[model samples]
Target: MCGIVGAIAARNVVPILVDGLKRLEYRGYDSAGIAVHTGNAISRVRRVGRVAEMEAAAAAENLQGTLGIGHTRWATHGGVTEHNAHPHISFDKIAVVHNGIIENHEAQRQQLKALGYEFTSQTDTEVIAHLVHHYYQGGVSLFDAVKQATRQLSGAYAIGVIALDRPDELVCARMGCPLLVGLGEGEHFIASDVSAILSATRRVIFLEEGDIGLLTRDSVVLHDKNDQVIERAVHVSDVSLASLELGPYSHFMQKEIHEQPKALSDTIEAVLENGFAAGLFGARAAELLPQVEGVKILACGTSFYAGLTAKYWIESIAGISCDVEIASEYRYRDAFANPRHLVVTISQSGETLDTMEALKYAKELGHNMALSICNVRESAIPRASELVFYTRAGAEIGVASTKAFTTQLVGLFALAVTLGKLRGRVDAQAEHGYQEALRQLPGSVQHALNLEPQIKAWSDKFAAKQNALFLGRGLHYPIALEGALKLKEISYIHAEAYPAGELKHGPLALVDESMPVVVIAPNDALLEKVKSNMQEVRARGGELFVFADLDSHFSESDGVHVIRTPRHVGVLSAIVHTIPVQLLAYHVALARGTDVDKPRNLAKSVTVE
Candidate 1:
């Protein structure tokens, strides 16, 4: 969930490493640090603060070097302190900046302490530095030392290392985490993400599992587990630099929330032109979709919520049994292996380590027909899957996802309609009607965006409340979960969601005047049931914030605030309802003075379990 950037170049790379970390600031970090191989020794500057502080400290120290590794750390092993920051050192011989957990760090730390290696930081990453130093003391090269140290480690990691003795070379490796080698003119870079080093190089080699890379100023040598040289495809990242800029917006969350319309349109452009078919997922999807009898969706966080919403559409409309499992939990349990069941993985950044591991676990259980719905076209999950669908929600920098969630719904809905048609669940006319509705999806979402002013005004009053209850019924219940997730993620308000029918089960006890209740009451089959639940809240003096359809006839009253979304669009109402919900969360965060773009302890991509 942290960020890593290493640069080997002829010119001073301090600025490059620093700027890379700044670009990656959206990935959420509590501390920032950098270690540079100076003229004769490794110089380090670690700070328990933002990138700007680290940059200033580096400037004060005149930390000039042609090669360095930098990190923005999300605290994992220890407390958020300078002592636990990255750029962990080992007797000043080796410095490592790592992203992801080292599962067996305690064992390594004990062994290292026994071997007379002193530790300065309380971090799993420090074990890596010490282990590499221990191996290098045997007169082995840094590359072999890193490889040996990595062999003893268990768990996901992407590490960039610099040795004082090997200032000319930087060794990096990845195991179950994303770490790419960026090829530049007379320079080489290693970063956990392509966006971090986009300024220095667009051409990158995405390392595979157990891949180790040795980098110099002018060349990069990659080797697989057996020490045999390997070659992976070099992908030219098309992430425009402008996409990273906030432009007129105050935060990335705001920009991404408003960008959903175009993002949704682009995701379904191919489907809109050629009609919804199994081939839209992939050329082999037609062959695979026909063989599917059930579906198991594995995802995490916002992507998991998207899967929950998709389950309603697939089961109700496509007439297929669907199950949504948290990717992190999927590996812990023994799944009922069924080869005929289609395994679908959803992720905004295909590099989410938990979901990727779940995908591998699903494949191991004889479920080989895997499909991925992801935003990044060249991400690992899509590459690993037999079938893939891109969300086209380009470069989501916000830690709390907006466009990515809505766009994933678009892809999932398309999959539902395609499956419905193939299974005879939907007739030709019904399929055509679904297509027409999809064609207007972008416009419908845009119309929902128009409710932002109303939502923002309501947020001024809602932000004062500390707890909230988001209620919906049937198809809209997942949306209520999503709405609650958004409010708690960005606004830091305690929020919970429940099926409207289950309000009296337990959640109703928490509702009172101090509690704000957000309800999704579209004019679906259960609109009356949802309205009854709203009355239940209002009768208890619980303030109500409702996002209802224009046809629902919901209006503002004493302690009740209503924002009119577009007319209900059936299962697609979930998509339209998401916009106002997102806006409310964003504006509430603004009112509460919380970090909307990078929420506390949350990373844009969950690359660690």
Candidate 2:
């Protein structure tokens, strides 16, 4: 949930570190800091607020160096103050910047205290600084010192280290968090994310788990945990800097919301051209996917919701049983693994810590095959899986996901159709019809986007409300859940979702004129059942806001407001219905005057447990 960028270059690296942190600012942070080897001593500057404030301080100090590391902190183990910022130094010997949490930091701090080492900040990262500095004594080299120090740390970490005396080199290590070394001409770099260094270098070496890297002005070396030399492939990143630009939009969230149409087209174009097949997932998918008797999807947050939406499709269309689990909770529980079950993991960044751990645990329990639906191809989850489907929804900088979520749905629906065809559940005519719907999905999403003006009007009234209720029936309850999540995530509204049939069970007691109810009313078999539930809400004076299909024949009435969407695309209605709810959340947050891109207490990626 933090950002780390470092460079050992021929020219001054203070500007490089600052620029990298600015690019990484889309990942939410509360404090920014950087430490550089100034040829005399380590010059460290930290600020409690934005990256701009820290940049101003560096300019005032005239900070300059050839080697440096910078960090933007999200306050995991300490307060949001300047003293709690990163680039933590010890004995003026070494400065360290870290991304993940240290589970055993308290024990390490106490042991370091016994060695007469004084600590200043209340951060777990300070212990890392002291450990590296303490090991750099008695004729030990900087490379061996970092390697030995990392052997004792017991948690996820992606660290960048710079020593006062070693001004020409930088050291970095990765365990569970994502880290990479960027190779350049006459220079080298290290960063927790590739986006930080996209402007400087496109060639990158993504370090694997338990790998430590040593970077110098001219050479890059990598080693495994046993201190033996290792080799990893270097891949040029495909993310264009132009995609990172918010050209015409005020916020990245808004930009991503409007980009959903093109994003859907890019993600499903392969399905449109080649038709749905098991081979589309990967080379091994044809051999492994046909053997699948059950599916268990492991994901977190928005990806978990995507799995929930997929569950309805896989079961109904594919005629196969599917289960979705929250990856964080699945880690501590006992799972009954079956050899024929396909364990699927979904993540946008592909570096979600708990989901990766859960996949490992499933494999440990005798699950033989795994697949990943991810956006980043080189990320941990995709490499760890036997098969993968990459979503073409490029870099999602907004903390609240928009394009990434919808693209996951597209891949999931494709997977369901592929499985259905393989298991003899779907005939040729049905498969062709599904393919047509897949091709029309982009146009349908664009049709939903046309409701933005009406959604904005509803948001103006929703901004004054304190709570909201979202309702849906079969095949779309997950959409309602996602809608309620989006409302609470950005707009800061207390919201909840329930299957419309469950209204009388308990939630109906909260209904009043002050409460707003948002309904997902498409023209499906359950529409009449949902309408009866709407009548119950209207009887209790609860205002109703319905996103209905064009053919649903819904009309505005007392205490009821209807916004008609485009006609539903048969199997892709859930994805189309998702657009309006996302727009409502964005416009509502706009009406509330909140930060739409970086919401409070949330980061674009969850790299820690």
Best by TM-score: 2
User: Which of the numbered candidates is closest to the native, going by highest lDDT?
Assistant: 2
Clashing residue pairs in candidate 1 are: none
Candidate 2 residue pairs in clash (backbone atoms < 3 Å): none
lDDT of 1 by residue, 1-609 (tens): 899999999999999999999999998999999999898999999898799999999999999999899999998899999989989988888999999999999999999899998877789999999999999999999999999999999998999999988889999999988889999999999998888999998999999889999999878999997889999899899999999999999999899989988998888798878887888999899899988888999999888988999898899888989999999999889888789888999998899988999999998889979999999877789989999999899999998889999999999998888888889898979988888888888899999998878888988887788888898887778888898999999999988989988988888899889998888999988888888888899899998888889999887899988888899887688989989888989999999999888888788878888
User: Cα lDDT of all candidates, in order?
Assistant: 0.90, 0.93
lDDT of 1 at 526: 86
Which RMSD does model 2 reach against the true structure?
0.8
- Candidate 2 C-alpha lDDT tens digits along 1-609: 999999999999999999999989988899999999999999999999899999999999999999999999999888998889999999998999999999899999999999989999999999999999999974597888888888889999999998988988899999999999999999999998899999899999999999999999999999987778999999999998988889999999899989998999999889888888887899999899899998999999989999999999999988999999999999889989999999999999999999999999999999989999999979999999999999999988888999999999999999998999999998989999999888888899999999999999999889999999999998889999999999999999999999999999999999999999999999999999999999999999999999999999999998899999999677789999999999999999999999888889888888998
lDDT of 1: 0.90
